[model samples]
Target: MPTIWLFAIVLVTGLAGFALARGRAVASAGGDTRVMHSRPLYHGLNGLLTAMLPALGLLVAWLILQPVLLDRAVVGAIPPEVLEDGAARSLVMADVRRVADGLDAAIAAGVATPEGLAALTAEDDVRGLLGQAGVALGSDVSPYVLEAARDMRATAATLRVVMWVAVLAVLAIGLGVALKRSHADYRARNFVERGVLVLLVAAASIAVLTTVGIVASMLFETVNFFSQYPASSFFFSTNWDPSFSGRGGGSELGIVPLLWGTLYISFIALLVAVPVGLLAAIYLSEFASKRMRSVAKPVIEVLAGIPTIVYGLFALITVGPLLRDAIASPLGLGNSASSVMTAGLVMGIMLIPFVSSLSDDIINAVPQAMRDGSFGLGATHAETIRQVILPAALPGIVGAVLLAASRAIGETMIVVLGAGAAAKLSLNPFEAMTTVTVKIVSQLTGDTDFASPETLVAFALGLTLFVITLGLNVLALYIVRTYREQYE
Candidate 1:
């Protein structure tokens, strides 16, 4: 049976077990609710959990293990000549799988008989027959590959049948045991509660596991990159050229220019975002009327809801050209539409909502009594805000700014569309420059060779970006904690 059909059967059985167990519990209590240790609902949930959990666990394990075991068995069956190296073995295995799938398709379409397929040989034009049945092959089928493919198909079929039988047997056994234990004095509520707590812990562990997986994968690839390329050249050199083919020893893979562009663009973005967003937040939280606040806050937040790609397009067609003509060219800075200024300006506009919304809430969280006390001490409104409200909210405001800075640094779309793909360490904002993210995308695009430094360097770049962002977060936390303690 199909996996989905098996899942449906298990689910239906569990649901049926729930109803049966609930009825049994009520009957054991003599239809008196107060006589039972737990509610009917808890008893029902206990039965459902018992019927489903073991069966689902077995099914998942079987699915993960089956392919691996079958692949090993098939690989053993193949001739030693075909298993030359890792890449060669992988390619041959791919062909074996494709041929197996094609044979299955041909049989399903009635274009090939089972007996004919069993009797097939390499000399019998197997690829032509498969092609006639709409299964194309890149090369002629060899005898060894054909044998391996046949073995793989047969093993997979057998394992699938075994999986279904085992899962069903477990489900039946669990349901019987759960129903037998459903008595008036049974601790069904405690069992169900413990199971729920286990599930919650498992859910939380997934996030931690995901972070570990990301770090491990990047670290492995970065180690490979550094093994082939010198660490000193990658870190300290100012050049940024990468040879697509891993042929040249002269390919400069330095990250200095990329890092400079990233920081420079982020700095410009913050220069525009911090003042505007902070001022807007102060006005909205402190001065705006209720009617205006409601309307204006939502309007400003709508910018955050707008997609980054839309902002990229705005930067490309509108903002980039506008800056080049109106500001950069007139001031004799540069004539390029795609420049650091264009991307930074558009990215800043995109970050405004992050700063304003967070700062507004942080400012509003300050106690009203603090402001009142300041006013009674003969301080003016402006003095009261600067000395009392902003000071109290300074930690949160700094955190908001740091968060915006992180967003700016990680931005890709605006940098790609607005800033041209030229990794440069120039100081002029009007000059075209690209960040590490843009180079990462460029290096990884198209038919990439994973073993090449050109491709592997993307992982190194990713790890660097991760470290930079992590340091920023740590700094933000430390600052927030220090100031928060003083206020408390």
Candidate 2:
């Protein structure tokens, strides 16, 4: 049977066990709700948990292990001469899996009978037979590989049967045991609660585990990249060229220009976002009337909901050309439509909602008493805001700006469409440049070998970006904590 069918059967069995167990518990309580220790729903949930959890756990383990065992067995059957290296063995295994799938497809399509499939031999025209069934093989089947594939099919079929029987048997046993325990005095509520707590804990742990997995994966590939390419050259050199060939001597895999562009663009973005967003927040929170605040807040936040790619397109089609003709050409600056200024300006607009929303919340979080106290001291509204309110909310405002900075730094689409793909360290905002994220995309695009330094350098760039963001977050936290402690 297919795995999906098996899963459906198991689910249905659990649901049935839930109803049966609930009915049995009610009957045991003489159909009197006051007699039982827990509700009928709790009893039903206990039965469901008992029936599904262990059986499903076993099913998952079997699914994971069965493939490894099957691959080992089939690979073992291949002759040593045919298994020359990892790549060659992988190729042979690919053929084995393809032939195995082709046989099943041929039988199902009615182009080959079961008996005909059984009679397939290595010396026979296996490729021709498969092709007739609309399954093309890259090469003719060898005797060793053909025999291994036949063995793999037989093994997989037997394992499927075994898996079905084992899962069903466990489900039956668990359901029967839970049903037997479904008495008026049983602690079904406690059992269900414990199961729920375990599930919640597992859900929470997944985030931490996923973060660990990402870091470990990047670190491993980055180490491999550094082993092949010099770390000093990658970090210090100004050039940013990547030769696609795996033979790594020709490529100038420098990260300086990319890093410079990233920081330069992010700096420009923050220059635009921080002031406009902060002023908007201040006006809305302290100065605007209630109706104006309500209307303006959502209107400003709507910018956040619009997708980043739309912002990228806006930068490319509308903003880039306007900047080049109206500002750059008149000012005797560079005339490229795609330049650092175009992307930064567009990215800043994209970041405005993030800064405004977060800063609005943080500014409002300041106690109204501070403002009242400042006003009682005969201070003007602007003076009260500048002296009392901003100082009180400085830490949170810093955090909001830092978050917006990180968003600007990590932005990809805006930089790609607005900033041209020319990695350079330049002072002029109208000059074309690219960021680390753009280069990472460029390096990893197309048919790539993970073993090559050119491809693996993407991971190194990613790790570096991760570190920079981490440092920014840490610095923000330190500043916030230190500032807040002064008031506390």
User: In candidate 2, where is summed lDDT lowest over 10 consecutive residues?
Assistant: 82-91
Model 1, 46-109: lDDT tens digits are 8999999899889989998987888898987787876865435766888899999989888988
The TM-score that candidate 2 achieves is: 0.87
**Residue 154 alpha-carbon offset, candidate 2, angstroms:** 5.4
RMSD of 2: 3.4
Q: What is the per-residue lDDT of model 2 for residues 1-488, given as tens digits with 9 covering 90 to 100? A: 68999899889989988998899999999999689999999999989999988889899999989988788879877988768754357668878988988888888888888787778888999998889889998778988888888888889998999999999999999999889999889999999999999999989999999999999999998998998899999999999888875458489989999999999999999999999999999999988999999899999999999998999999999999999999999999988899999999999998898888888898899988888999999999999989888888989898889889889888899999999899988899999999999888888887666667788899999999999999998999898898887667
Separately for all candidates shown, the number of backbone clashes (residues 3 or more apart, or on different chains) is: 0, 0
Runs of candidate 1 with Cα error greater than 4 angstroms are 64-67, 77-154, 246-250
Clashing pairs in 1: none
Clashes of 2: 0
Lowest lDDT sum, 10 consecutive residues, model 1, at 242-251
